[model samples]
Target chain A: MSIFSNLGIRGSILGLAAIVTGIGVTRSCDGGGIVTSQHRVDLTFWNGFTGPDGRRMLEIIRDFNRENPDIQVSMQRMDWATYYNKLMVAAMDQRGPQLFVVHASTLPRMYRSGFIENSARLYSGSDPIPSADYDPYVLQQVKFKDQYAGVPLDIHPQGMYTNAEMLRAAGIQQPPADKASFMRALRLLTKKSNSGDASQWAFALTLWRNNFQSLIPQFRGRYLKPNGDADLNNPGNIAALQFLGDLSREKLIPPPENGLGWVGYRQKKVAMVWDGVYMLGDLLRLQGLDYVAAPIPQIGPQPGTMADSHVLCIRKGLSEAQRTGAETFIRYLSKNSIRWAAAGQVPARRSVRQTPEFASMPVQSAFARQIPFMMYPPRTPVLFEVTLEIDQAVEKVIRGNADAKTALDLANVNAQRGIDRDRAEQKIAPAGGIQP
Target chain B: MQRTGFLFLAPYAVSFAIFVILPIVVSFVLSFMRFDLTAQSSAGFVGFDNYREALQDNYFWSAVKATLLFALMIVPGLLVIGLSMALGMNAMARGQAAVRALVFLPGMLNIAVTGILWQWFFNGEFGLFNFALKHFGGQGQPWLSDKAFAMPSIVLMSVWWTVGGTAIILLTALQQIPGMYFEAAALDGASTTRMFRYITLPLLKPVMSFVVVTTSIAGFQMFGQAFMLTRGGPELSTRGVAQYIYETAFNSYRMGYGAAMSWLLFALISVFGIFQIRMMRRPA
Candidate 1:
């Protein structure tokens, strides 16, 4: 009944292989002579860095191309909003770039797509990129079954962005670092008008998913178990949600429905917000806004924040020269990552972070302090579904539609159903079935 | 002659088979299987499971409800506004073209631009709508974030974005209704309202049926306006079935489920279309 069956799996595979080999042969010849004397390996690098960060990445790639004569790396930038979909399609068609960038949290899904090269290939050279430079926790995110999926480039961790003028007006000289002081500062900064409406807000939930990811771990809980089962309604998660709900209930912050807190902070009305370090570019563009960046305060028994890294990934099934060129370019980028850090991220390489140039960046350095304890979303192929459930539950709790336990309980059930469905589907799937 | 006609139809037929007909057939087959993109090696038949899963899926049902609610708001709004505009333009002795062009301007802009433009208007903190409300001594309304207001806000934007094209189509149909009918009714000393009710309403029934069926179909498939505005937020209250299918197939990589939902939506649209035609075909 199926068309693939009419062609036969082996027949289709042979047809696909012939087409791929034809394309590869033509592409591999697209180098040498016109631009340079030597036979260069032209590597196409794709990434979703279409912001101010894109400019910095362009500069880094240009520098790398100038430095390396035999390997030419051309970069393509796309918006992160639609990047993964495009990447997946390109990979499926076997037209993917030689090298690409994926977020550390997205590594699992991309790995399952079966297009990424193992990390062993990245470290196979005589002068390998040292594994010692990266934090094991960050490294662990890219690992799958004793092999690494990609190389971690930089960590963008959520940190406290505070309006210094508002804090000073409230008689606070330093940023809050713990729960007691954080609450004290919040109360001191909050002002009420005659009608009891909030005149000046103390804090705001900027991005609920990011804020939830940061807070849930501070309360010492997991959204997904080690086996990738839903664990959203844990006691610590409930406590964390209740704490945030109280902030809204007491009017210490506006409810999530009002607007984005980042906008309020930009207008200098909200005193503080926990946001990613990548937001530094937006703040720097604002005129006359006095702000300070610090690590997110420990509000619930521990210090933690959500972090995601840009990982350098090599596409699977490249020629030996292309693979080597990809690894070489990745090594060059890793060594020169301080420039990437300057663009608004914490360099994942410890040696790069320890440099004086990186230390000079107050926000990056402050956010870097949380790298040891930073939380990456659970590595699961069903991550998108799980996150959707968590986002809905958090929104429900913060918007007062349901209590924390009730909302998360519903989310837990929904996410668990998704996991179960995926498992059941996989179990019945025939081995070596045709790829669409 | 037949061979020559076949040659003329060959290009279109070939493309139709490749792009449209083939995909439909493949997806129909895919709906009864497990076709996970991430696990291509494991893809296989699982008869009726995807459909069964969708029937029990809460999110799927919510998506259906959201889409139905959207259709309920938009279809009637388009008909009333479009019919009213056509009637107004028909009565105009001068500046009819100018008024018609003005009514059609918003429809010319792409959905992305319209969505983004209206998103700025609906933003609670600094939106133009909120700014105007505050200037009038009214409190700011959380346009896209309140469950009570979110779908209505989306409907309001949808009306502005699409009513122009609908008005233009109805206006063309209005112009086709000959002046002789009204004149004949006038000879009988019939009142304007009476003539319009008896003649205009009956003549317009076929076009009105066309409008209603097409509008309902488009409304059910709505994705861009809500996606660009609230991202189906305020706890997914505005997320329609199309967006849910997109997320399931592309974002979640569950191709079988997405295809199954797509067939279900196709069935729903077909049912509504047939019901509309049947109801409209009845004698006045």
Candidate 2:
């Protein structure tokens, strides 16, 4: 009797395990088969838009699905910090989404990995988004080695956000437009407490990298030389660094630290801060705070600011039908990007920007004025490493640990070493031309 | 009966091979190759070149230094603080269970939650700590921004988050010690300190050694706390080797180099493990 009962238990356990495995396999296979059997093209879209913008994108995706029954587009969103790592791994394993988003600045690295399709071919479809419809500078961002690498969706530039209440208390009506006026405003708005600590300030360097990058271009600081070497310590860049360091040295800005500078501005403790246009939605959600946006003040000799775009890219290795479907979805998103603009981004297409709907977004309109002169970081495959070096140098100078010149010189050496290593690994001949 | 037992173990054995063993084996092979994901066509056997580069890399050395400094801070803190809490709990006359449960509660919170909560507390401008300090006529210190304070702040959060579980383990071991031994020591005119040092500690040696080794191992592998808190910053002063490896491999796409560093870290942990075992072993 005991032996018979044990046999019965073993049979049931085996049956249960087999049933579970079968269900798992069949469920996954069923998803694919049902779509394909109906002659529908299934497209997976991935992006890192886990904010208010994510909701906007989801609504658009829903509209697209309802409008286009032939294509099934599934969207997945994650935080941007870990998104690129996950995307690259998925692409490497050939299990990537059919459609995805890549930052224009990250195109070169993604391109080098051979996963991005030549998006120029996407224009061959019906109802294509004309190349001329996009802002030229914005279009140039997604172009790599004479090929259009991705479709530009929106441009997010670093601009000045001001506390109107604090500025009014300081007797400033208009934001600074140029370098001299900016310095005057800084002096006028800065205040000290009884303990000799800065209680209110004209400006806070929120993202030091973007702040430095914005200043560098205004000073005509070239990050890369014609010879493909890093020029981080050039005269223009050093002057920009000195300007930033002076802000800290003069107690116009707080020390480079962990405090949320934006929070200070929202609470009316800070007069102004330089952040990206993406912060518009956040500020709008904050009630009882009077804030406004303006073009970044001319800290250098000319007008310029740092900007990057979210580009739509199709994964390689898709079927012809899948490719066509992905392109159709991208073009649809581009055509209707005024919806995207409501989520606090400047649409990349000039036609879209010129529309009445986009004009009504006051914050987007202010930031969009600088689209003609927005500077992206150097378009290198090793951009991440280069930016790390830049950030380290900028932090050292701002924190008063090292002088601007010394820090930049060290950073120059480090950046050049990284670029040289990258070049050697790729087997590109140094300086002049390719090896014979 | 034999067949049924084998069948019962097969699922776990299969998963272990596929998930754990396979990755280790693949990474070992990858460490010897030139596996740059961006330029995959150029991948080939480089035979220890990745390891050689790591030895000469300044960033790698800095990362190693940060990891060691963090381990040194957290391990001893965990041991001392955890033991004190355990001793206190063991000496309690009533509500010991409730107290033990309360002590272990923080460990149940997720690492990300712990990090975010502490980040708010450590914020220099408008943080809770700074607000309290200002009320007392004191100035706020740059807790997460200064290189000197960043790691210590991370350690403080880690102790609050992790020491609870360690204390519970120690408390369990403490409860196992016979009350008669302590009674005898007291009857012999032994002081409380002497009783603790001579009777309690000697009995708790094995558990203590286990705790030390495990905490040290966990400390060396620290990533999430520092990643979320300082982001290896105030100038990469808090970037541990694990974060460095992550950036190198995934961010830079230098898989071979990253795998090489991973092995180097593993070797480092093993060396510490051996040394700790030797030091903690009871006299033969």
Candidate 3:
């Protein structure tokens, strides 16, 4: 009888342990992860629309959830910096979201990291997003080593935004047509000893990675050689740098110290600046400022522009039913991304791009003109590192801290080493193996 | 005696062995291997190649230089100011508790918020630093735009936020110095500086060593301020080992390389940590 009672106690302890394990497993599955049941499809959707855009996204997700309660879609919104970090961690752990958003430039890195699903079957055979419905350039941006997978969501291209009153005061009747015209425009608009002398400057450029890369193409210089080495040391690149350096040095534009591009333009201290549709919300809120958007004037023999986009992808680990749910949810979002366009993005779907709504938005439409000529940095696994290297080089050059050639040379050396390191890393995967 | 000692140590031994010792050993060994961060995994024995490459790489050395520069800037400054505050607090002054809390408040604030606040404060156009300069009938110099100013800005921000914790530690050490010691110094007709030098400095060495080692370790681990404020820029002037490690691990997904950096940084910190340990055990 005593032995029976001891056996009963051991059995009860084992049952409690099992119960604890069940709860642990439930927490991962009930909301943010793969569903246990084949009958109930749970979807995890991630994006970086944490701005005012997030509210609209939440509303859309709410509508979707209300209509299709069977397929529960959990909208995970993180900030831009942390969004990618979380996705990469989830992918590394082999328990990622069913669907997520990433920049077009970042897609290559994600693909290489095995954070993205490579199989065509996941989204190809009868998936709601047909390949033909996307703009070719936008579609091309999300391809992984020539393997197209990410459903392109939006196009965010760099364009010239001007303060109309400032431009008119400079006696410029029209926006500049070419590099020379642009230079003259800059010279005319920029007034140093003017009324707001110490406080204001004119014709500010948002000099950073996006705008830096955009300027390269305008100088008739390539950002990268066909062999994938940086081409910033070329003569065209030199001339372009000199012109920009001259602008800041000669007092035709604000020095690196005056980092008031968007704000100065909005407040009417500056005449012109270049940025993406992301800044449209800032402009829309500005009052009493007569502003207009225009296609950036040709900088070189080739008319090149900066266009970045966000690509939606799936995490590596999930059941077959979960993958299907994720794909369906991506298709649903892509189909209904027009609401997203109203918030600032140009819808990635071609049909949506051709609609009256897209045509009506002046800034978005002007930004869209350069779609065929748009370029991003090399879509490699090391692209993000390369961008950092470029930023270092650009800062040195812009601050007059280092010459353009020396800075570019240093950048090239660093980029090459990064590429080599990346190759070495890819050659050595850790542990035995992780499941898909 | 043996049995009682074992009983007292068993739980701690088990925990230390599991959490600390195991991870340290595994990671140390793993540092000499190569691995990818992904669902599909395979690891290769890399020997001392990761360390060799890190030594040879300019970026790594640049990171090292930046870290050392940061350590040099923060460590002594933190100690001097912290101990000074502690001395002030050790006196039975009015509002001592309130002053301690006020001094300690910055350390409790989030690093991200601190960076943003400082960024605005240092902004050339609308920043408070420039605003104050204009008030003095002076020109606004770029506080964070110039590479020279960038490092100083980050260091200043870090100093403001962290000195409080260090002060608290020093204050406790001051309290423990004993009223009898001070009275004895008074009897000897020793000046205030002499008392601090002879009595206070020697007794405080233990806690001083503790403060130095922990702060040194934290100095190398600086990331959020650089990441948030200048992004290690104006031109990579402010990037440190922790930021580089993070970029490698998460941004690049080169987990093996990142691990290699971690162990390398561990060795770097340990060398300093051991020195502090020796200093504490010294004849003084």
List TM-score per model, in order.
0.93, 0.94, 0.88
i-RMS values of the candidates, in order? 1.3, 1.5, 2.2
Q: Of the true interface contacts, what fraction does each candidate have? A: 0.70, 0.79, 0.58
The CA lDDT at A273 in model 1 is 95
Candidate 1 local lDDT, residue A76: 92
Clashing residue pairs in all predictions, respectively, total 0, 0, 5
lDDT of candidate 2 over A30-68, digit per residue (tens):
331124545687788999999889988999999999899
- Which parts of model 1 have CA positions greater than 4 angstroms off? A1-25, A28-38, A193-197, A428-436, B1-10
Candidate 2 per-residue C-alpha lDDT over B1-284 given as tens digits, one digit per residue, 9 for 90 to 100: 99999999999999999999999999999999888888788799999999999999999999999999999999899989999999999889999989988998999999899889999999887789888988998878888999998999999999999999999999999999989998988899999999988988889888988998999899889899999898899899999999999999988989999999999999999999889888889563
lDDT of each residue in A232-295, candidate 1, tens digit only? 9999889888888777777778865567599889988799999999999888778998989999
Question: Per-residue lDDT for A171 in model 3?
Answer: 84
True-vs-predicted CA distance for residue A50, candidate 1, Å = 0.9
Candidate structures ordered by DockQ, highest first: 1, 2, 3
lDDT of 3 by residue, B32-121 (tens): 877656423556788888788777867677787788888888999899999988988878569999999999999989998898888889
Chain A TM per candidate, in order of listing: 0.89, 0.91, 0.86
How much DockQ does model 2 earn?
A: 0.66
